[model samples]
Target: MRKEETVDYHIKVVWHAISRMYNQGGAMKGITASSGFVLLNIDQDEGTPATKIAPLLGMESRSLTRMLKTMEETGLIYRERDTEDKRSVRIYLTEAGKKQRDFSRKAVIFFNDKVREAVSPKKLEAFFDVMTTIDNVIEENKNLDQKIQLIENE
Candidate 1:
């Protein structure tokens, strides 16, 4: 199939476009799309656990550690020892972090609102259904590479 016709190509292209848009919007706030995402995932009121943020953002702990350090240095976030679990750390947003998070939220909502206005509700529902199906297919094929390797040995 042509690259333009491939599902993965379209998904990747659209995601990159979205990322670029977010990065542009975040630039004004002195944040990148990634940092904005991290800020939003952190709970401002109660603080989120250090371990929990990585899974929420689908990031590796090492990458998050570096990002968190940068955020701390920038005065966007602070780390506190978990009171109940002394070994664990909790991440809380500073006032600056809250402002950035709000910006990210509004940007996301604006994008969604524009998309919703352009697409019919029925079409939007169909799109969501297709995305869900794609996720399920991926889960079902989790062992596909191993199975393919086994077949290749036969």
Candidate 2:
């Protein structure tokens, strides 16, 4: 099959386009797309567990560690030891971080609103349903590569 006809290709293309747009928006606010995403994932009031942020954002631990370091140095976030779990930490946004987080939220809302205006609600629902099915299939086929190799050898 042609690369363009594949689901993965389309998903990747769309993600790249969206990432570029978000990065541009983030640049204007003195942050990168990655940093902006981290800001958005952080909780405003209670603070989020440092460990939880990576999984919630689907980010690599090392990447997040670097960003968190930068954010801390820049006074955008502060970390506190969890009271119940001394070894665990929670991340809280500084005032500057809250402002940046607001910007990220606004950007997301604007983009989603525009998409909602352009696409019918039914189509959007169907798209989400299809994506959920795709995710489920991948999860169920975690050993797909090994299975494929065995079949090829047979």
List TM-score per model, in order. Answer: 0.88, 0.91
For candidate 2, list the clashing residue pairs, or say none.
none
Estimate the TM-score for candidate 2: 0.91
* lDDT by residue for model 1 (1-154), tens: 8999987798899989999999998887899989988998998799999999998987899999999999999999999999999999999999988998999899989999999999999999999998899879878998989999999999
In order, the Cα lDDT scores of the candidates are: 0.92, 0.93
After aligning candidate 2 to the native by TM-score, how far in Å is the CA of 13 from where it should be? Answer: 0.5
Q: Write the per-residue lDDT of candidate 2 for residues 38-142, one digit (tens) a residue.
A: 999998998999999998887889989999999999888999998999999999999999999999889999999999999999999999999999989988998
For model 1, the stretches where C-alpha displacement exceeds 4 angstroms are: 143-154
**Candidate 2 displacement at residue 12 in angstroms:** 0.5
